[model samples]
Target: MNDTTRTVRLSVDCMGGDHGPSVTLPACRSFLDRHPDAELVLVGTEQALAPAAGWARCRMVIASEVVEMDDPVEVALRKKRDSSMRVAIQQVKPDGNGVTMADACVSAGNTGALMAVARYLLKTLDGIDRPAIASVMPNQHDGFTTMLDLGANVDCSAEHLLQFAVMGSALVSAVDGKEAPTVGLLNIGEEAIKGNETIKRAGELLRAVSAAGHINFHGNVEGNDIFKGTTDLVVCDGFVGNVALKTAEGLAGMITSFLKQEFTRTPLTKMVAMLAMPMLKRFSRRLDHRRFNGAALLGLRGLVFKSHGSADALAFENALNRAYDAARNRLLDRVHDRILATLQALPGAGTTAANEPPAARHAA
Candidate 1:
């Protein structure tokens, strides 16, 4: 066992992703090699964990079942009680001795199922009504922008967006070391009057929080503003956030394919490509999505990060690195503190106020 004060124990679902153990086990090996103070709890079937047996700093937890990439949320929650994914997340829960089994959990599994299991098992933090998925994206300023609700809660209230801003701010602050990260409300335009009633209301709530010395709200921002690094954190409902994220991913893929096609079009182009290989490689490295592979399920009592189901070894390793960083930084505690502070500052708008009288609380 590592004697370092910063040792982080991470639970990994070895059989959850597209390539299963073939991808995750190698990624675990690479992660352990780089993080000497980190330990891993590899959760999967006995046969699936055979390759990881010889790895140092790793302990295997046998699971009898596997959750497929396309399994429905109901099936994962109800049928697969002993699935590798569920078992991995279970490790984040406190054991019979009231001690946390792991610092955090990482999984490249069905997004819906992971969220369902995590929420059901670990539950949300003190003042957060719902959890949001926050991920870092590359920006024009050579820094990263964090965006939240990236497919966790499709329908959100203005209050939910407000809570998301708090959680996103806490996440960026903890992981990126930003003392007070700026927040932007994703909308149709930069003006105050744009977007639906829900967005306008959300903006109002964000401003209120800012005035209360809770968040650094930067008003409204458009889709293009995301790449410009207009704010360190962006908040939106899952429906819109998911659409924006997928669109960006599709555009990146298309651009890469186009460049490849053009470069291989002719011998003349191939010669030019060889001449510019150094510059092209640098550009590719900067925009590679693998560098930002993990998305945190913020607001949970315990930390849980979701990786792309088809992530390769490098990408999976990046996900593990992100989880390790969050755990080391005490992200869960930071989020809880921020939410509790915000609730205390606002008098009648208590934490439970948002959940009670659902219609009135959700209305724009």
Candidate 2:
């Protein structure tokens, strides 16, 4: 457990997303209202973040630039060195006294740029070759299933997958209060020989670590298993995880759209819609993607969370809340400690990596 007495400070990029300060400012205000022990370092242009200047427990950090939603990774890294996205991430870096400005960072910026800037600034934790993004998806059991590599590293080796599993487990255990979360290798079938060579090897590695008491391995799980809540965590490469996330969002939208269409299609159909309104509302709320807006960039030396580029005030607030929860639980320490312990138990497994670097851009 973490000591609740310490204030959890967060750095926020107020000008990164589509709506920019219009959306982020309100979210930050709402977050501060709920968390009396939290402080915010608002990073953006002077004029852009002027409104937050008077807010108590908040500090304004001037950023001359903003990373647009369509900005390329190279431009964000080289050209826009003073971008709010970059500066916000910088808050997590320790100062000359080894004291960090913020406990974590939250941004609704270009996913690729955020990941790139965060990795370049914080670097990866020891034994972690690359950082991965982990987020939760609503499942059937009235709970969320944690999944990782959600578009950070499109191509992953068996060892990289093992690293993701270790980081993801720490995330769940820290935030969700799960002592030993079960891990499932996302594959086409439940059998050990179902996936490609990389996945098969990953499964073997997961089993080895599980037997050594480092993780709780639940063998293999198919795509549908993710929605079934069959496991606490799902491990996969970025390509698959991104596709799955977008597909789930699309399905939710479709269901809500279909209901709207039926409500006004005809008078007789309208009556049926009215009868089902209560249940429909419940179902729609269950699938709203806004409730699960924050995605954690794991394996970094510090904590960084990415919110949807188009998130509104409510969604962005949820992202801030999630980051606050993780920080208060000492998520960074948990991830680093878990990785080190697991790697020490199985030498030559977590530190090794493939020759190719991660892709230039993550999935938008």
Candidate 3:
């Protein structure tokens, strides 16, 4: 059924995460509770969700088999014809057209499996070297930081990084509403000849691409500058981005825990904590990972947001909101068109990508 008369429907992979329905069910409930205009298609065994969900009545797509987190990507894909991750993607497929007219899919399952399934089912858009996972990191400033290839692909070349820079630029523009967001190359130092060959090669290529006005490349930035908002977008390989993100999350938890312990150590400290409760809460909210769980799998034909496995009801709700923002912004379309436009202006304007239209390249 059409859950709303306004926004598009979203397919939730109910069986893909560590907490499974415990996390997924509450999230689905929270999403519908807030956004009545968004419809959802839950993909997982009714039995699996029955215990966790109190008989949710959203449009349902029964996924008979579930690939557990420990299962291998290829092995799971081979057996589970009706797995939650696979079916969730099918609903968003333009060919399938099962979930209204939305160009999106979301899953909290095995990171590699989700990407593999999406790549096969959704396919990549034209001129997109590869699909990169784009994420938002809260900045120390009033705004948020953006990064791409956040574990979508472990290996990346200069061309891939160049493409990522372009996608990351557009994402920051659309998500942050920054017209010309500064894009940075994730590197060891500010010098032109720093780090390994890949970083050096990618660094030089990004400079050329940015010089051509594809993006506002901000040379090179150290790991510490990520939270400082030195650049609006940071382009890096999945390995580095993933490790950095995980470290930041761990540090946030440690910081909060330490504060709690210190505040309860003495009556005076407790009194001070009570007095500064509001400011502390605001600061904590800014650091909360729930608001930042969703990551967009960009360079694909559609919008696909991946949330953390431990994501609770709030994170799932935010994931839905993120999907709505991306779809309405025509994000993928804008990125593809921009890429083609840039390619057409190159020396071999008549070669490679010019022959195919945006829709044609994305038309799986």
Candidate 4:
């Protein structure tokens, strides 16, 4: 359990997302009410932060520019230097007094733009080549499955996948209190010979790391295995992970819509729905995508979480809570130690040119 006495400060991009401050301000209010030891720094234009003017445990940072939801990564990086998104991420850095400005940052802005700005500002953690987006998804076993590379890096090498596994293991261990989280390499099939060259090579690396007592590798798992809770963490390239995530979201929406239509089709069915309203409510809550809106951009030197662009107040609140949890648990430190240990356990792992790549030489 995390220490409840310590305060967790979060910087929020209040002018990002479709609803902008309208959604974020209310969410902040609710989040503050729920977490007494938490503080917030809302970054946005003056007008956008009017609603939160006199809130306790919250302050406003004036950002001149606003990053639109459709803003391109280049535009956000080059044009909108003072955008709310960038300002929020900037708060994650250490101050002159050597104290961290904020524990974490949360934004519901353009995904590509957010990634670009975050990478430029926070940079990657030691032993991390590229940062990956990781989030929790509900599984059939009534527990959660954490999947990574959710649209961060579309193309990845075997080494990148291995890094994702190491990072993902640390995340689940820190956040979920798992001693050694089980990792599954996402593949087309469960067979050892099923994936492409990159996946097969990644599997080999994962097996080696598992043998070294770093991670609990569960062989390979298919797409269905994600929902089956076959493993605590699922590793894949961003392209496949993004597709799987969006597909699951779409399927959940479709199922909800179909159920609504069926229940209202006739008076008898409507009566049955009313009779089973409690069960329906429970089912709807279980499948609500809003409950799982926050996705952590892992492997960064500082913490940054992304919320769905279309997230409402409730959804945004969940994203804030997720960020707060990560900060409170000192997730960054855990990830750093795990990655260092994993790198040390590799065969012939040294700083020599022939032993490892130049980029990975100082990863530890």
* Per-residue alpha-carbon lDDT of candidate 1 for residues 173-275, written as tens digits (9 for 90 to 100): 8789897999999999999999999999999889888999999999999899889999999999999999999999999999999999999899999999999
* Each model's backbone clash number: 0, 0, 1, 0
TM-score list, all predictions:
0.94, 0.94, 0.87, 0.93
Give per-residue lDDT, candidate 3, residue 359: 31
Per-residue lDDT tens digits for candidate 3, residues 164-251, read 8878777766666676889888888989899899999888777766678777888999888899989999989988988998898899
Worst-scoring 10-residue span by lDDT in model 2: 355-364
Total backbone clashes of model 1? 0
TM-score of candidate 2 against the unseen true structure = 0.94
Candidate 2 wrongly placed segments (more than 4 Å) = 348-364
lDDT of 4 at 213: 96
lDDT of 2: 0.89
Q: Highest lDDT, which number?
A: 2
Model 3 stretches with alpha carbons more than 4 Å out = 1-6, 48-58, 96-101, 266-268, 345-350, 354-364
Q: What's model 1's lDDT at 214? A: 93
Q: What lDDT tens digits, residue by residue, belong to model 4 across residues 177-235?
A: 89799999999899889899999999999999999999999999999999999999999
